[model samples]
Each structure stands twice: as structure tokens, then as C-alpha cells.
Target: MKLQQQKYRLKLCQPAILPLAVLTALTASPILADETDAEKEKARVIEVIEVTATRQTENLQRVPIAVTALSGAELEQYQIQNLGQLEALVPNLNLHVGDAANAVVYIRGVGQLDSISFNDPGVGIYLDDVYLGRVQGAFLDVVDPQQIEVLRGPQGTLYGRNTIGGAVKFTSARPSETTEGYVSVLAGNYQQRGVKASLTGPLIDEQLAGRFAIAKSSRDGFSFNQYTGKNDYDKDSLTWRGSLLFTPVSEFTAYLVLDGSNQNPDYSRTPHRETPIYSLPSGDFLPVGEDPFVVNANFNDREELRTKGVALTLDYQLQQSTLKSITAYREMNYRTHLDLDGTPDASFGIYSYEDQDQLSQELQWLYRSESLSLVSGLFYFRENSWSLGGAIAPDFFVPLGNGVFFPFPVISAGLRDQTNTSYAVYSNMSWQLSEPLSITLGARWTSEKKQVSNSGEEFFGTGIDTPQGMQAVFGTGIGHSLTGYDASQRWNDFSPRAVLNYQYSSQTMLYSSVSKGFKSGGFNGRLTSFAQPYDPETLWSYEAGAKSLLLNQQLRLNTAFFYNDYKNFQLSRFSIDPDTGAFLSLFENSGKATTYGAELELQALLTDSLTLNMNLGYLNGGYDKLIGDFEQEVSDERELVNAPRWNGRLGLDYWFDLGSRGTLSVNAGASFKSKTYLTVSSSDLLAQPGFTLYDLYVNWQSQDERWQLNLFGKNLTDKRYRQHGFDLSASPGVQLGYYGDPRTYGLQLTYRYF
Candidate 1:
């Protein structure tokens, strides 16, 4: 579909609202004992949920924030294999995978656009309370997780910097006191195969315990490369984790976790079929196959990534409070080779590599009572990273007159060496003023220093050695020599939060809060000359929300309305000069912007065998002030990227007894999103139309819960949609896009032993 004339207008239909109102009404009604057994069964469908949104365990209905929590079973039921699947289950969230190893996660239209090593993500990712340093390795696959929590809006008070767009927390299951183990095998289309296993048992009676888990999955690419006769997006990965727990006494405990992963995958993109406007010297445009999955490429792009990490935690309980300490170390090695031009002519190719290591330590003190609660902590972090890469553009050689020709340069190489050190102190306190009224306050102070050294060489001209027996026709001059420079910077920030909550009844509560979020600034490692550093970005968020449970715990409803004011918003854009053919990118502090949105979550037991879950989100605000280079006023036309006007999901679940042998359950769901722009430039080439996708799952389990089987299908309707897009409309008039998976179906078999 062409995007030049596309329009996206919000549509609020009655069908979506009527069901939510009916669920709310059911929650408010009481269940009478005189009713039939079916009624009793419906009233008993409610399940209690707990979350650690505040760094402490609490009932979900008592938390005063917009959060979505999913258990391991629920994740499996929804076929949440990796982080990319999360967008379909959460509200106002969009996860776009840029490649096999990197992604861009947007919340309320705020997020990072670049995945370079030097820049940090606005949305933070954490595994078992340890922060993941880069998005390149943050696409963690779900492997026997205890729970997953997605917190919306600003969360700097507790999560600190890099959480201006919110945070995602994944908590793995700990060691069990009793022996247990489970294994599963799965097979699907496109030669897909997967196996996962986990075991937990006591090591020294009641004093020690251990747990171990492993997962291996491989699949052929959905798209086929006709030129190479190979799959274009294949994947093979393996991951393993182990944990040990020691309980020396009743008041003290220690836990350690070690994990590692290896991933090898092919490139994840195909060229567009549209013809480029720019004609080559032969007066012919590049030809791309009509099939969406086929591409004409000379290079077989690939990557290999390896990661390792370890975390240790200690806890000691006192008479009135508890003290805890956590230490973690992580390392990663990544390398990639890709065809940058996406053509069969071998116009240009790129090879990039990175090596990094990080360490962090944190200490916490917690005090809790009936009327007062407090949590305070100190954190220290350090990281060292290095990267090197080069782009080869052999097509630079152009023929002059007759048989004479100039062999332009071959490659442009660059490298980055950086070190970062940071420290912070944070505290959160809550006090009850009366039986139904309470107040909470939070503050965090952080300081950071970053040192960087960058060097590069542009081999743009010709070389001395040539078959034509001629001196250097163009380059090989002193100006092309590699040069290096050093840079350093320091930053400090203070974030605070205030909240007022009131308990209206035994089953309902209302809350309002104001908070500040921050993200530290850093150098742009990709730049070769006149490197400009961007300033920090900050946000102020105000929110009001309500949490309630009705119908004797059979129904749940939560809602929140939020508005955010952003200052010095950091925006990154890529530009390919038409005159020089140089690819340049810049990170700058854009003007101020504002956003307002609302979110709703509802879960209800509609009947004895039927349950309903739904989420709806709306956003309307955009950039109120902005400008392009040369001080051109572009405020009225620019908007935030990946921020759709409306997003929603509706799911229905049903279960029935299959005689005395087993039980069968079925799930059907649909998710929809409005049109969105992939970049801040708002170029027509980057626009994507609205789309809706459906999924289905069926499961059968034995009465004793020892054997199980599941059949699942995603994108059941065979809808085609783009997950990401790139703009190249200046003279080529051609745009490139990475597509989401097509229709896929699979079956899984499982067995458990105790």
C-alpha cells in the first residue's frame, strides 16, 4: 500500500466499550449461594496475583501503578517465545526487531531508535534484577521464568536512569526445597525444532538447594533467497542457567546465579521490488524478484554472538529491618558481516565487531511495619567496551573515457574505546496518615563519568596499485590517514516522586502521583569528525489511577491516565548526502514535546467455562515545538516515532473436561494497532498502515498433570505486516522494510516427574 496519502484517524467504537462495561457490572454484583453449581463455578474463577513492582512483594490490586504481570504458565499459553511477542499482550507498547540481535521497544511513543554500543536504551531491560547493558543482547528468550513485569511510564525513582520510557523485569524461578523436573519438545513449520528442560532439588537437606535450566531452538528462515538458494533469516541458539541457594540460619541467606548463551543467525532482511530512480552507468535499474521473500544479493550475511554473566545476592534480617547486597558481572562478544547495499552487484559490504565487560554492586536496607515502610539503597557500576568495523564499497571505481578508469577507495574503517563509571543513592518511603489515607515519597541522586577515544580513516580515493599501470588516480593521500581523538564528560541528576493514595472501600483504591525520569548523555561513537555530544534527556510525568476487584474476587479492573512533559528530547536521524554519497548520522537534543495517554485492563469470569481478558490504550499528543537543520520550523509536521494513536487486544479462554482422562482448553485472541511512523523524520517511506492479527491455541492435559500437549497458531489469518522500515526516498525513491513472521503453526509435547 502506498503511504503518501494514507490517513490514520482514531476510531472509538461501541463494541469495544460495551464489553468492558458489562465486565465491570458483573464485578460489582454479588454471587448468591442459592444459584446453581454453574454460577458457583463462575464465581470461583478468580485467581490471586502478586507482583514486585515496588522491589517488594504485594497484592497486585494494592499497587498504585500501571503494570502488567504474566506468569510462566500464561506466557507459555500465549506462545511468548521471546521479547518481541510481548507487544501483543501489553497496552501502548510496540516491540520492533531491527535484526536478529537488536530491537527497539517503544512505550507511549518514547524510546531509543539506535542500537549502537555507545548509546543506551530509554526503556530498561532487567533479568533477575540485573540490568542488561545493551539492546544488542537484550532480546532474552523466555526459559522457565517465574514472572514477567512491564511497568509503564517514568520509573526513575526506583529504577534510576535509562528508564524514562519504563522498564521490563524478568524474574527466573529460584531453587526448590523438593526435587522436581520437566522437559518439553516442539516441532513446527519451516523446519522448526525446540527442546527445553529444567530440574530443581535439595542439595544438603534444608540447608542448600540448586536449580538448572536449558533451552535449544533452531528454525529455517521464512524468506528464501533465490540467488543463493538459501534461507534469508535462519536462527540457531542455545541458552543455559544455574542457581544455588544457601540458608545457613533463619535470619541469613545467600544465592548465586550463572548463565550463558550462544546465538548464530543469518541476515534478517529482503530487498524491495520497487525500481530505484537512480540509473547506473549501464542505464539499467536493479531488479528485485516479485516474491516478498526473494532477494537478489551477492553476500551471505551472518552473525555470531556469545554472552556470559554471574550474579550473587546476600540477605540478612534484623529485628526491625533487613539488609541486602547484590553483585554482578557480565561479558559479551559480537561480530557481524552484512551486505549493506542489499543488491547482487556487491556495491558495498560491512563487517563489524564488539567486545564488552561490565560490573555492578548494590546494597539495600528495608524497614516495613503496619503503618510505615521504607527502602533505601546504594549502587555502583563500571563498564569497558571496544568496537571496530569497516565498510567496503568496491563500486566506487568508475570508468572515464575510452578504456581509462579511476579505481576509487575500497573501505572506511572506524573504532571506539570507551569506559563508564557511575554511582547512585536512592530511597523510597511510605506512611499511613489515617485508616484510609496514605502518602509515598521517593528520591534518587546519580553521578556518572564517561571517557572515550575514537579514530577512523576514509579511503575514498584511488590507490597506487592498479592493473592499468597508473599512479594513484584519486585517493591514497596524507588526508586519508587514520586520526584519533579523546573526549570525556560528566553528568549528575536528581529524580523525585510523590504519591497520594486513598482506600475507598475493601475492594477498591484510588491513587495519584507525580514523578521525574532521566537519561544520561554520552558521545556519538559512529561519528568520524566534528563529533558532537548530546545532552541528557528528562521527563516529568503525572498520573491518576484506580485499582479494584469485584464479584467476590472473580473480576479485576485497573485504569490509568497519564501526561508527560519532555525536555531536551534526544532525537537521532540518518542522512545520505545526494552529492557525496556519504552516510551520516547525528544525535541531537530536539525541542520540547508533550504526550498524554490512557490505559485500561480488565479480566472477568463471564461463565462457568468462559473467561475474558482485554486491554485498551489511547494516545493523542505529539511534538508541539521542533525544528530541522538550518533552523527550519517543522513543529507542526513532526511527531514521535512508533507512537500509534490506538492499540488494543481482546482474548477469550474456555475449558472443558474430556471425560475422566484429561481436560481441554482453548484460547483465541486478536490484537490491533493504528498506523505508525518508524522514524522521527515522518517520511512517507517510513509509514505503516494499521493492522490486526489473530492467534489461536489448544491444550490437553492429563488428569494427573503428568503429560500434556499443545497446538498453536500465530498470525492465523495470514496477515502481512512490517515490523520495521528504512527511508531512502531522496533520489532512489525506494524504501526497505523488515517484515513480521507469516502464518505459523506448531505442536508441543511435555512430561513432568517429581
Candidate 2:
């Protein structure tokens, strides 16, 4: 097996800042751009520096940390609605859909890929300062983001759970003691449509204020089902956010935020690879009219996810220390059609499946000063899930003992109802020992347990068994297997992190840290005959980096190099079974992997009006050591699926004032990903070539900062590719999958009043 090599790319673009002539002409641009003379001076320094990278809000360049921040305006301008969008634009980070709202986010060569929610995320995703509890509902259809802060390296010290790789914080806009509102609309190809609205105003003068936002989008899916008739499939989604602000005293304030999202895709199941492709080299603009293979007709997979939460924060200022408390409650539900892949066949009989899930969580914390800071929190997560599956009668002459085959897909609908509970307590402290150095230390103890049950039919790959089949096979047992078994597994982790920082000067700092990460193990699906589950896996990272401002502030560079040692890496294994031409898969902890990577971010302000931003990420990753029990049907050494060794981005923006009436700005961004494996069996050769995507946006605002309009186009090059795919062995030669979308263009408008 060959290992993956290091790869990365960097491009140069014009600055995103405005030209001197334009800036000079815009002394009074759009209302939004026409900030107070004093306000303009402060913003000119850092473009609304973010606070998520570190625990405090300060000059971005002054923070001795590596981070990337996208403001609410930036997100709107770029149309970064989901994690997938972030992955395309950010370096090193990768997010792939796992069925529905379940997006697997891998960072710096570490992350979770399996469908089981029991596993922990190497990277943590946070909304409104609250940690998201599950992978299934983590990537909500989102909008109106205030700021998105991407902090590289281990953040286990403060963020606590599932922060082994790094952390992503999404801040939502809050209500102010004022009045404001906006509206946006988008229309495009494939019947794509989107609408968003936001309103915020005083309920009782300065004492109370409320803010609300709602967004909805739908588009006809690109895939076509031969059996479902012409023009099949389209995706639909909805997102909402609301906030309340109450501040009776100038020194004391309280913030409450409520947010949620829903997703329902017309086509949940992957199209069988044997199926047709849309717009091949022929540029037909439509998928082939007929199924190329006989097994492509049963395309039935469905999924729905709902996440709702409320977070409350209170802050108080005292003589010596400023105190803060954040409390939150959240509930998430996920349900999906059992067959993400096409059904076995009509002859296989009643091919059907479904899973229902519920998840809930809570967190709280407090912190003091930067020199002596303390943060502690309590977290509780619980989930209840159930799955039922059944399949049609099997086809005869499929090489079984009897010429008459029984319903093959399922002898009975597999049924499993499970309950899981996890709780953790964690704390962290950062201390400054002297003018030149500081240290941060933190740890968390987490415990989890689960219960599962199966009533009725067996698993598909459990080895077919029939009276005649068993007799023919020397009684190894008929395809029939039964179980009323209840299993429980529990474990605890003392996750820890420490970092030491040395300040060489006001503009630069060097830092090092050691951190650990883990993913819990749980039940595997029973699509076949019986059930299988694996053990938990763990990883430790040793890292060091430098944050600096060079070229007299013309350049801001931050880079980190890391060595990750993985133990029992959880991965899906596949092998061709004798009964079926297809490959079978079950999650297992196997092999040790060593990975090294570095991230480079450069922000340059060549002139007061022109600025350039570029980021590069390269990873030298492969399974350095591996030991496991598996059939010879698969290869051992290969690149991990969906992990691109290199990813990069370059962006440029130029701002201007149009004739003193409003502001005009233009920005362009491009992203590139090196070649990567789309499937586990890298040897079989189903991969995506390196692809680059480009985007551009132009905006104009009203004389009043209150009204603004934005025009955007994504994937200007119209790149075609697939992000992820999977195969199953129960049904011979049965492999189906999905791919990414094409270019999209739209316009949005907003109006603010205060």
C-alpha cells in the first residue's frame, strides 16, 4: 500500500480592501459604511476582531493565538451557510455529509466518520457559546451568523469535550436597545429559491429589546430516478434564530438566544453507481433517461432533522474582576429513512428501514481576568433512538441450496431501541507567570452508557441459512438468527490539555501544547443477520506554532505544526463476501496512525485601501502502523477517505464609495483541494481529482447604513465532484452514492433602523 504524500497550494489575488481613491470618495458612503467618525477609527484597526479564538475580546493581532474570523457581514457576502461551505473556503478543515444533517468534520487529520453518535468529535462545533452535543444535528441550515471563529490546535483546556482537533465557534447577532430590520431573497437554476427576514426592536425602550431571524431554501434535487418517473428529487431546508436583550443597568446585561433548523431532502438514498450521471462529457444537461443496470430502480431513502435551543448569558462588572455566566438548554431530533443506499430488489421483498432519535444537553461557565482566568462547566447529554428494517424476498438461483429463494432482503424487520446518557464536568485556568510567559491547564472527566435491543430477523451478511441451505453447508446454521440480547458499555476519560506561551515582543508569540482526544464506541447496524459493535478510540497531539505580525504590520502570519499519535483508530472495513459481489462494512478500531501538518495564514494590507488574505494547509498523513483482524478482501495501507492532504484559499476585496450616495465593494475567493480518496478501499480506484472552486460577490448599499444589497455567485467555474460515498456487501454489486452541486447565483438585501 502506498501512503499519501504532502500537498498544498497557494494563490495570489488582489486585495479585498478599497483603493485610496475609492476610500477618499467614500468619506460618506452607505449608511452602514458611513459609521461615526469615531467608530471608523476603531474598526480600521481590526475589522471587528473576534473573541472566540481566545476567551476574551481584544485586538486580533494582540491575541497570542491562531484563528480565522468571518463577521456576520462577511458570511452574508460569502454565502457561507453551512459547515460544508466553510470546508470549501477554509484550509485543513473538511466536512462531509453522513446521511442527513449529520456532517463529519475532520480537522488536521483527526475527526469522526462513522454514523454512530456515541463517538466523540475530534473537532467541536459551538453556537452562541454553547457546545453542540451530537454530530447528527450539528450542521444546521444556517443564516445571519454574527461571526465564525476557527481556532486551530487542541482547545480541550477551555471548550472541554470533543475538542481534540480544534474548535469552531458561531456567534449569532443579539438584540440591542434599538430598532432594526432586513429582508433577503434568492432565485436560481434547478428551481432554487431562498428567503430570509430579520427584525429587532425595543419592547420597552432601553429596558427590553427582541431580535428575530428566519431563513428558508429549497431546490429540486439533481438526481433522477428511472422508476419514479421524470424529474425526481429536490432538497429543502429551513432555519430560524431569535434573541432577547434586557439591561436595566449599564454595567449589567443579560442575553437570550433561541435558534433552530430543519432539513428534508427529496432524495435521501444515494444513487446507485450503476445508475446514470447527469451532464457527462456530453453536456446533456440532464441525467440519462434509463437505468444502466437492473438494480437501480429501488431508490428510497429519507431523512429529517430538527435542532432547537436557548442560551442565556449574564455579565457583571466589579472593581477588580468582571464576572460572567452562560447557561443553556437544547433538544435535537433526527429521523431518517433506513435505506440510504438503494433497496436490494423487489424480489428481495419488503426492503424498508427507519430510525428515530432524540438528543438534549446543557452547559454553564464563569471566567475572571486574562492574567488569572478560571472557567468551569457541567454537561449532560442523552439520546434515545430506534431502528426498524425489513427487506423483500430474495431471488432464486442466486446460488443458494434450494432453487426457491426466500425473501432475501429481510426475514423480518430488524428492531432496536436504544438509550444513551453521557455526563461530564470540566474546568480550565490560564495564568501569567511573568511578562514574557503564560500557561493554561485544563481537564475533563466524562462517563457514558448505552442500552440496545433487537427483536425478530437477523442481519443480511450473517451467512445465509435455510433448511436446505444449512444442510448443504454442513449445518453452519441457516440464514435465520435471533436475539433478545441487551448490552451495556461504559467508560470514562480524563481528557487534558496544557499550553505554554512565550512572548518575544508585542507583535509575536511562540506556543506549545499537549492534548488528547477520544471517540466512544457503540452498536453497529443490524442490516444483515445479527449485530456488531466496537471499542472506543483515542488520539494525542503534540503541537507548537508561532503567531506574528511581520513587515511592519503589512503581514499577519500564524502557523502551527503538529504530530498526532492515534491508537485504535475507528474505521470502516470492507471485504467481498462469497454470497454477494458487494463489500460488507462494520466499524472497528484498528491500527496506529501518525500525522503531521501545518497551517499558514497571511493577511496583508498593502495600502490603507487594499488588503489580501491567503491561507494554506498541508498534511503528511497515512497509517504509519496498523494491526487488525480482517479478511484478505481489502488492502491495509491507504489514504483515509475524505482527508485531503492539502487544501487552500485566496481571497481579495476592494471597497469604494459610489458618488457619495452609497458604498460599492467587490470580493473574490477561490479554494482548492488536492486529490483524495472517496471510498475506504483506496486500491479499487474510485477517487476525485484535485478540484478548485471560485466565487465572486459585488455589493451596493443605500446612503443610509440601514439598506444594503449584495450579489453573489459561487463555484463560478462550475466544478463537478463528489465529497463522500460508501458501499455495502449484503447486496451483491450494490453500490450507490452522491456528489456535490454546481454553480449557484443569487442576490440578498437588508435594511437596518436604529
Candidate 3:
């Protein structure tokens, strides 16, 4: 086996050295500003954040979990518009786009890479307390968000679904009683144009309220297609969300939310060829490219994705407790056409269609008292998903006797239909043993059942070109049945969590926790025949953390250390079919693994108008025992996929006060990540070297806070980096890579009224 040499030095300790040193110095130093009334009023102290990571609202600092919360204002300031842009803000979190319709997300180096309908995501995504059944629907634009929270480690007690790695929660803004609205317009390079608006007002006097928001964005393609004389990888999308709040009595309230998004982008999955042209054993050549943004593709079509959902939540407030119920229904439809070979001769192409829908219901009871707090919930979910796809490769060849080969075109089609149902009961309670100490215990019982029907056909030709030649091979040059299967699986798990907390001081807290998580198993939808189902994967995590407000509330620092034991690791990779010599993507149990990591977050108010924020993460560990295909023990030399050795971010924000006009603010930040492998095999050709990205933002607001203007730049240095890759050298003799967005600058204007 050959490994690619690292292009950059692996300064394993350099990335975290500066941040840790700075944090230590800041912790030892005194407050930078005096506590005078004017200074105190003008100073920007780290704001207190609220989160629902534990299935109940609580102070972020008080929550005994590893989590990060970002408010709407912070998101806007950071210029994060979608899920893929959030990789830099959070620790141990990785997100990227696999295709125009699928989002690949990973936390702590654990996640599902296959976009098959039968597989489940390791990192769960929830919007407005509704669990998204498919990752295709998880890439919607952020619109009118109240806050976004990322919970790290195993989240099995509260979020009982497939949250083995972690969970991400998105909370949208609720309807307000007062009448208010805002409109924003944006323009940038590459013919970028967008508009976003939101309005909230009282429908009836103190009885009803409503909120509506919409976002529309469009941008020219970044990649140039030589075959069509047009651009590829363009962006065009529209998303809208609406909600209504009803309150007949002060103790009773109901909220109904409706949301939808549509994305129609042109040829968004055209990956640039990364390998050199290769000559097959049959004397046929495969095309390749040198540039990452230039591609030659014979097939180009617009990809379409449509998603809609509705959720209703009801809450009844009592003297010391609250009872809440939520009901939600969501559905998605997606279609895509791609040229996999990246050539103009139609060497390889594919078309896919997906339809999915889900329904979920949840009930919760939250209770709070002077020395005790408790939260319990019941959840039920049902989903139906269907997928149809076809692939054609005319340059393929089949081997004959005596080292001879014949031209054999390969054509295949497949369909998968699956139904999944789940039920769970969970409860978490915290008891205050004393004024400064507490103990919490939580557990969840979950049962899931999955049923699937898969079928496919494959056709091979032996240099058959004419009508008579095709008639000799088969009646119609279509295909013969290659695969047909029906399967069902049932799984049950009992997850538990325990935490001990100690309030060391008024501004400092320490906590330790142990938790278990589970992910249900499923059959491979891309298989050539029926096979034994894989077993469920599970993880046990041990973590300790500290949350502190130091330097007299001018500085906030949070730190965590975690160790995890992962068993029955589910792995997805390409394997050659022994019978037909065709490439097949399948899933298997790859044995046990271990992962350990540390994270640190710091925020300091350097001066009355200046604030500094920084975060650093370190990860290490890999497979302890890996079982390869044919049940052979494989070497454990490859690094874990998507797990970088070092990652960090540093930023500064300063405000310049204009006496009578308004406030001018400048924000600058830089994010860096070490070498990362995109695939499970850890192929060097598909790896991303260490790189840093710099971003800047300048803002101006009117004195009345009703008018605002901003200018932002991303990837200021134009650092070229790969976001995803595919290695098909075994069959197609080609490697492909998808790159991150290049340098982009834009201006936005907004107006607000109340």
C-alpha cells in the first residue's frame, strides 16, 4: 500500500500552544477595565446563553454537558448561512456536502457517510424539536433562528434516536406580541444576490400572534464545464417559515409552525478529476483533469430538492410544573443527474430520485423546585422512504480466457423502499444534595423496527452494436435481474447517563459524566444479493469539564476532556463483486475503536469596546481492531476519517462609538485545521492538508438601531482546500475531489421597524 506524503509540516503542538498560553496569562491577570458605572454600562460582558440540550431550558454554564450555543446575532456576525459553514465555530464538529441533496455531518469522528435511504445518521439533527428523518432535508438555510446548539459526546438519554456521536438543535424565533419586522438585501461577487425578510405581529388583542420569514439566494457557478460551455456547481434556493401562537388563558398556550424549502441548482455534483489519465488493460483510456474548478462532463442537469414540514406544540403551565406536547410531519423529494466519469464521451453517468416522509409525536413533563429539577418525555416516530437510481458505463470491459477481453458495456438500475418505526421513553432528574453539590441520573429505553425491499438489474454486452447483435445477447438490450431481496430487523437499547456537579464558587463549576449511546443497524441498499444484517453500533463515553466566569465577569472559559469506547463500528466502502467483478458499495461491522479528545473555549472582554474569542480542539485515537472484507484482520495504521489532530479558531471584535451617528464595529477571525482524511480507507490522494482560513466583517448601525449596513469577506487569503473526495481508481481508474468555496466578498443592507 502507498501513502501520500504530507504537503505541510505536522506541527502537532503549534496550533494549541498560542491559545493555551494566552488563556493562562489572561486567567492570571487582573481585570483590564475599572468597575466604574460608565465603564460597566459600556463594557460588553460575555452574555449569558440559554440552551435546550438536556431537553429542558437551562443556563448554558449550569448544564453538565459538553455543548456550544450560538445566538442569531453571533451567527450573522460570523456570516454562517448554512450547516456546512459551521465547521469552524464548534469543537470536534465536521460538516460537508456530499451532493446537491445530501449533507454529511460528523462529530468526534463518528458519522454515517453513505447516503442510502436504509442507513441512519450517527449525528442527529433536530429543528424546532422535530427530528429530521433524512440528511437530504438537513441542509436548509438558517432563517429567523433564535439560537443553535451543538451537544457533543453521546446524547442517548435526552435524544433517544441515533445520536451516537452527538446532536444539533436549531430553535427558531417565536411569535411576538409586539409588531416588528426587518428586511435585508445582499449582493456580492459571482453575481450573488439575496433577500431575507421577517415580520412578527399581534393578530388579535393579546390573544393571538404570528411570525413569517422568507429567504431567497442565488449565485453563479464556480466551476467551469468545458463540454457544455457553461458553469457548474451553482446555487439557487428559497426557504420560508411561518408560525402562529394562540393563548386563550395565561396558563395555556399553543404554537403551530410551517416551513418549506426548495433548491434547484445546476449540475452541483461535478467533482474535478484528481488523477492522471489511465489506460485500462483493454487498451481503453480514462480522462482526467488538472484543475479543481475545471471539468469536462457530457451530462448536465439541474438538481431539485423540495422539503416541507408542519409542527404543533401545546404547553400547559401549572404552579410548579409544565406539560408539553409536540406533533410534527415532514416530507422531502429530491432528484439529481450526474456525470461520474467527468468526461464528454458519457463514460459513466447516473440519475437518482428520492421520496421520503415522516411523522413524530412527543410529550414531556418538566418540573422544578428549590432543590430539585426533573424532565421526562415520551417519543414516537414513523418514516417511509423510497429511492430509485440507474447507472451506465459504456467503456467497461469483461475478461475472456487466455488473457483476452471484450467490450462489455455495464448498465444497472436499482430501487429501495424502507419503513422505520421507533418508540422511546426517557427521564432525567437532578437532586441538589447540598447548596454547592448535585447529582443527576437519566435513562432511556428505545425500540425500533425496520423493513426494506430492494431489487436491481444489470446488463452486460459483448461488443454488441447492431440490432441483430443485441438480439443475440438478450431480447431487448435492457438488462437481466441481478438482485432481489426482502428483509426486516428489530433492535432495542437501554441507555443511561450519570453526572456529578460541584459548584466550586459563585463563578466557577465542575462536572463529570458517563453516558452510553446506540445506533440501530440496517441492511445495505446497494447490495447484489441478500446478506446478513449488520449489528447495531454502541459507544460509552466518559467526560469531565469546567465552566468558569473569571476576571470579574470579564472573561469566560470552558474546558472539557472526553474518552470514548466505540464497538461494532459500522463502516461503508466500495467492494468488488466476486461474481461479476462490478463495484459494490456495502456496509459491514469493522470491530472496536477508541477515541479521546479535549476542547477549550475562551471569551474575554479586553476593553470596554473590545472582545476576544478563541477555541481549540485536539483529537487522537483510531481503530483497535479492524476486520476487512473476507473476514481477514487488517492493519490499524490508517488514521480515523474526519478526525484532525489539531483545530482552532481565534477572533477579535472591536466597537467604535460615534458620538451622534451610531456604532462602527470590526470583526476579524481565523480558523485552522490539521490534515484530514475524507474516506474510511484513509487514501492519501483524497486527503486535505493543513490549512487556515481568514474572514473579516465591518458593520455600521444608525443611532436609532433601525438601519444597518455591513461588508463581509470569507477566505480572505483564497486558500484552496478540498471538502470531499471519491477514489474510484479500482474500477474507473479516476480520483475526484470537491473544493471549498473561494474568496468571496459581499455587502448587505437592512432596515428594521417596531
lDDT of 1 by residue, 1-754 (tens): 0001001000000112223343344334443224367745644556667898887788888888889998777777776788888898888998866743676888887788776778778888888888887777788888878889999987766753348889889999899999998888888888888898999999999899999999999989888876688888787999999999999898999999999999887654554433442223344456545666666665556677888899999989998798989899999888776554467654545656788898989888888999988878898888899887656666533334343434444566677889988888888899999999999999988898888998776654534222111212222343266666789999999999999999999889999999888888888888856467888889999999999888776678889999999888888766555455455566778788899999999887777557788999998788877766546678788877888899989998765545334555667899999988876678655577899999887666655677666677888888877677655443123456667888887877777777
Model 1: ten consecutive residues of lowest lDDT: 1-10
Residue 255's lDDT within candidate 3 is: 97
Model 3 residue 59 CA deviation in Å: 1.2
Instruction: Please state every model's RMSD to the true fold in angstroms.
Output: 8.5, 8.4, 8.2
Ranking by lDDT: 3, 1, 2
lDDT of each: 0.75, 0.62, 0.78
TM-score of model number 2:
0.82
Reference-based TM-score of each model: 0.89, 0.82, 0.91
lDDT of 3 at 12: 8
Q: Which of 1 and 2 is ahead in TM-score? A: 1
Which candidate number would show the highest lDDT if scored against the true structure? 3
The residue-by-residue lDDT of candidate 3 on 1-754, one tens digit each, is: 0001110000000111223343244334443433467555545455567788987788888999989998776666666788888888888888888854677888888887777667888889999989898989887588888888889988877764648999888899899999998988888888888898999999997999999999999998888999888889888999999999999999999999999999988765698888753333336555566678888887667588899999999999999899999999999998887777777754556667789999999999989998988888899999999887656566655434344445556666666788999999988889999999999999989899999988766654544332223323442436566667898989999999999999999899999999998988888777746754888999999999999988777788999999999999888876555676666676888888899999998888887767788889999998898876557667465668888888988988766555345555667899999999987767898899999999887666655777776677889898889988776655555677888898888777778878
- Give candidate 1 misplaced runs (Cα > 4 Å): 1-43, 160-162, 266-283, 287-290, 396-410, 459-479, 576-581, 730-734
